[model samples]
Target: MSRNILRHWFSVLVATLAALAISSNAFANTKNYTVTAPDGVALSVQESGNPLGQPVVLIHGLLGSRLNWDAQVGSAELQRYRIITYDLRGHGLSGKPTEAEAYRDGRRWADDLAAVIEASHASRPVLVGWSLGGAVISNYLAAYGDSQIAAAVYVDGVIELKGDQIVAHSEVYRDMISSDLKTHLDGERTFLSLCFHTQPDRPTIERLLANAAMASWDMQSAVQSMTVAASEGLSKIRVPVLLLYGEHDALVNTSGAIARAKQLDPQIQIKLYANSGHAPFMEESERFNRDLAAFIETAVIH
Candidate 1:
């Protein structure tokens, strides 16, 4: 073969190989699936990383979806572990039943989580909950028990669901559940703004807004109305617990909640992000990802 022809062929092969590598890496990191809850609601579930590695399930807060954990999902720190994130009922791409009964009492939340766990084919997977997701994890413990959970991570969330405590700790919650549309929208805007210590980039802000808008107000109200205190079952969780919160969080009283959770389980680990607010994972992603990987490595049971 001519030297010029040989060089051209080699370059073409190199480019083809690079493209194949890129495609393979993308495919290896993301998988989407649908799982049915006990009540017949279907959830949109996404899994990434090594499928056979230690499983970690991430549950997003109220009016949030799996996208809330996008930073963690795509992080290289979590690439060694199997990561599962799903939209809660009435949130994201998950099935939304308009009936009030569907979201009543938080049992459906537990069932939905159970279904996700079952679908992941993971035994005793670590549970990571942010904001209202903490309530879902607590409810899961109350309904299904913690036998299936290897560990738990509560991120700027409500660990103790006492009505008085909730009211006192978060006026944001009050605003979010308000009856007036203007009040609700205003509250949501404020709530999103409070989620970060500094203003997030425009793309991140837009994504957050889009997810918040997708949530059904009626379903949210129903869930809020039926809030059951999960404090009673905190003592029953046998696995390690990690509490993550932002120091500058304007949404919830992070200090009070951490103090309360410590009283319940003195052994629980706590990490406060110095400059972050409600969404530490989004605001301080590098530190959050590192800490999370460490926690899963040292704490979570296989």
Candidate 2:
């Protein structure tokens, strides 16, 4: 991240707080495109930054879309990275088929990602996935070849889930998604309070919640598929996997992920932000961008 952008963010943070009292709105613009998933569903791909730069495909979490990645997408430093993001089916502006077959245990979502990669025409591009997006990339690599990906970045979204744990945590994930979008928005407001005790300005926080609230979905399908992925064969993965997460993120513990990464692929790299939660990209944007740039620099982009 450039020092200028850092200073601008701080200024924006202060201005957002002051303006929050008058008019509560400060979201950067996000553009959308449609990509056909393998299942024939039109998934929505949202994006920002330079489109002609080194391609960087971004994936969001469960019940999330490109909007969740607003801060990074809107950052000035992104000029060098063509940051692409999208709404998985059933979330945000993507095509949502209620049929159980659409979600179909999760293959459809991963396939959608594949189509997006091909559509972008990004040869050996870097993939940045968050939470559910992490699993999607994992499944993508497992089912097909990832020689097209120069590197894969998993942001706070790798852990194992299975059997009873699925039912046990369904409500947890569902309730968060099932709540009145309004109340959920409010909750995120409070969540930012904690996630950014250091200094979460109103605009940054509002934009975050707004983008998040737009990510409504029927996650039951992800629940089912991810449960299966909890045990999916990932030991064969040879591509560079860089996992960046938080120390206090309740959804997935860092120690467990670090241990799992080592067990799965001794070649993997891991970084845990001391003051981050589920949304490290937003909470610790500087560190996140720094690590990401370093990783990209190391990647042998073809």
Candidate 3:
């Protein structure tokens, strides 16, 4: 979808449209920080907005880094909220244990995120996830309960996957990663390019490649465990849930995830970006930041 089309769909944590979407004359200030999750994963996080603003924890999906939220963290509207975006254990500068067990479970990733929130010293921050990040958030809620989470949002996320497709998808990724791991670096860049149709921001994509190699080689185990966690635990999440899907996302279908999440928690909110797909924040920065800020403004974040 065209960038103009995406603007009407999803939003970002940043206060203004990204430099790619709008003139550099208007933009939000961005900063970077790193924190350790409870499970010992040292996650790299990018933060923006007011120091005294309401806290919002952002999570990126599979093979994605916290840098994916660069636009969100740099938007003027997003300055209203304390935005937190980070790479999962195996995706960014985060510490990745070499053992298979450490890389195999979403619970560990959840612990890492929980630690980030507590480390920030925020009382209760709203949690937001995109794509596989949704699954991690779901698992975090299921594993830790919602005492620290005031609300949550999903941008083109999948709450559940049919058993067969899950297997098929896993197989494809397994083969892809395995074949690419020989050079390791080459594979990560290839994977990133596959994730986005547009050539990504140069420095950001290069940083992603650098971090991917920092991840443990036991990625297959991580993917499998996370898949199972999302499939089995979707019905148990209790916090206020929001599902935002891009209209044309092939990664996570709107109807399927909505129906599944509804079956699990009827209170879940589902919104569709009329002209967006998997990466709505990048595709539609302005409208997304506006709508997202408005939606978050409605939340009584303590």
Predictions in order: lDDT: 0.82, 0.66, 0.67
Worst 10 residues of 3 by lDDT: 19-28
Write model 3 residue lDDT over 217-289, tens digit each, in one string.
6664456555435544556655566777767665565677777777777877777777676777766767777
Residue-level lDDT tens digits of model 2 in 153-240: 8887654553311113434443454447665555544543434324566776566666555553455433544432423435666667
Reference-based TM-score, model 3: 0.78
Error of 2 at 162 (Å): 4.4
Q: Look at candidate 2 and give me any clashing residue pairs.
A: none
| Model 3 residue 143 CA deviation in Å | 1.6
Per-residue lDDT of candidate 1, residues 1-302 (tens digit): 99999999999999878655544563466889899998888899998877888999999987789988877776766777888999999999999988898887677888889989998888789899998898888888888878877899999978765542353425666777788878887777777886788788999888888888888887767876665446655667778999999988766688778888887778888898898988899989889999999898887633
Question: Which ranking of candidates, highest lDDT first?
Answer: 1, 3, 2
RMSD of each: 5.9, 7.0, 7.0
Model 1: lDDT of residue 177 = 74
Q: Which candidate would rank higher by TM-score, 1 or 2? A: 1
**Candidate 1 residue runs with Cα over 4 Å from true position:** 1-28, 163-184
| Count of clashing pairs, candidate 1 | 0
- Worst 10 contiguous positions by lDDT, candidate 2: 21-30
